[model samples]
Target: MSDEKESVVGASLISEDRNGVRTLTLHRPQRKNAIDRALWVALRDALDAAGHDPAVRVLVITGAGGAFCSGADIAEPDPTHPVDKMRRLTDVALLLHELPIPTIAKVNGVAVGAGWNLALGCDLVVATPESRFSQIFARRGLSVDLGGSWLLPKLVGLQQAKRLALLTEMIDAEQARALNLVTWVVPESEVDEFVLELAARLVAGPPVALAQTKALLNEGADRTLRDALASEARAQAVNFATADAAEAFAAFAEKRDPEFTGRWSVSGRAVPL
Candidate 1:
């Protein structure tokens, strides 16, 4: 796709598309990109759009100005019922988690509370050295939301998850990387370019196969070994039915780079990834 940019929900969120990557930027820099109600709705809409867009091979979530998200905008008084308000967060979280394409969280600065879980929801997280993270819910007298309760323990064992949740201690990038919360910690100056290149690499991959691989891994944790193998076999069957798989073999034989179109072999149509 050609470069395109649009502001959503009173410019509280910015959506940009470059090549095959769609970036959703939290745009409330004045509030350190804290997700207010408008932003929550905007984000949900953006993720839903990207998930359905065939041109979007990768999705990147980041913040504007300096900091990443600081969690929900609790300071902004909302007369909306608490449960209804939380439903917005749940929508964004589930949409992000269930998105078919690969996702990356480009953490520029602080990512706390629901913000931190937002990054955790992505397939990969690339943070700067100066970035700080915390599960600040405990300190705010709120328990984890935005899938933190489920994601944290899976990323770092149950004990570590408890320690981070209960203590609400701020951790640096290196420390977060040590806990496997971050995939890479690039320098502040290089992080943007690094993520761009990474996203480009993902964009070049076979879209349907990549989507299936992501699904397998996401669901594998809860499945038995035999079930996992069965799923993998099913996935490979689907992959082989795609033109990209045949293109891969042809490219290998020809000693050339494979161009993955993710087209169905029989119908000559794009796979419904």
Candidate 2:
């Protein structure tokens, strides 16, 4: 796709598309990109749109100016009930986690509370050396939301998760990386280019197979070994039915790069790769 850009939801969010990658930027730098109710709604809609868009092979989440996100905007007053307000966060988290395309969190600065969990929800996280992270909910008299309760322990183990959540200590990029919370720590100057190249690599991959691999790994943790193997077998059977799989073999024999279309071999139907 040609490069395209637009500011949406009263400019609280910016959506930019380049090649097959869509980058969603949290735009409230004045407030450290905090998710006010409007931004929360905008983000949910943006994620939903990207998930259904065939042209979007990869999704990147980042923030404008400096901070990634400061979590929900508790400072902003709203008449909406507490439970209803929280449902907004739930929608964004579930949509992000269930996205078929590969996702990358480009953490430019502080990612705190639900903001940190938002980054964690992505498949990969690329943070700058200067970036900081915290599960600051306890400090703010709030419990973890936005899947932090489930994702934190899985990433850093129960003890570490509790320590981070309870203590609310801010950590640097290297510290987060050591705990496997970040996939890579890059220089601020190089982070944008690095993520762009990373997204390009994912875009070039077979979309169908990558989605299956991601799903298998995400669900494998909760499944028995035998069940996991059965799922893998079923996934491979579906992969073989795609034109991309045949193209891969042909390209390997021809010593050429495979052009993946994510099309069905039998019906010629495409899966929006």
Candidate 3:
């Protein structure tokens, strides 16, 4: 881990890497960490870098202030054409979803509109008890964008997704959890510590297997039963070929804890997490 934190675009975003976990923080506290054009570009670049960085076993997204993202910064004028802006936003969302390593969204406060959808792009979402969420596009007189139309239904089912999008009602973290939009709802004071521990656990797991599992699950919903089964079998085969699989068997036979060295781009060897 580096001693200094890297600031992205004058601290509108920040990046820190520690113990195989790379955390990207939305840093616009004065604006409730809203997404401006610069911040979006910085986030996209960070995710792309993390995806290719073998040392990064997990990526965590959060906001720096007491609040998470409130949504897009509507006050800021976008110089870029609307079409190009949407394209960039789409690219960022896809980059986040397709990143090889696991991604977690740590929602500490309000996450509304595009901010909520951005959190949904992550593999897991943890929110504080006081965190509030809403799909507020309708209230803004704009239809849902940033892949919310696809992700919301997959998360909370079609009817509930409609209810949330249509009504644009704010829900507490507990309610979000009940609706399956949030993975866990913990106290605000413990969110950072809890996310750190969770990231450590994920980092300690077999990297190849974990990545394969994430890919499989992400694709499962769009595939037919037979297709999903075939994909699973193929993923299992790939996992079995990794050195970690043999290590696991050996440890099982010897009755000891198996140390997983998350092998990434390294050739002919495994390295410690």
118-146 in candidate 1: lDDT tens per residue? 99999999999989999999888999999
* Residue 166 lDDT (model 3): 99
Give a tens-digit lDDT track for model 3, residues 35-78: 99989888888888899988889999999777789988888998
TM-score of each: 0.95, 0.95, 0.93
Candidate 3 clashing pairs? none
For model 1 the local lDDT of residue 16 reads 83
Q: Candidate 1 — which pairs collide? A: none
lDDT agreement of model 3 with the native: 0.88
lDDT per residue, candidate 2, 1-273, as tens digits?
Answer: 466666565579989888899999999999999999999999999999999999899999999889999999999999999899989999999999999999999999999999999999999999999899999998889999999999999999999999999999999999999999999999999998999999999999999999999999989978999999999999987897889987888798899999997887855544332
Clashes of each: 0, 0, 0
Question: Backbone clash tally for model 2?
Answer: 0
lDDT of 3 at 72: 86
lDDT for 55 in candidate 1 is: 85
TM-score: the better of candidates 1 and 3: 1
Better of 2 and 3 by lDDT: 2
lDDT of each: 0.92, 0.93, 0.88
User: Where in model 1 is the C-alpha error above 4 Å?
Assistant: 1-9, 267-273
Instruction: Indicate whether candidate 1 or candidate 2 has the larger lDDT.
Output: 2
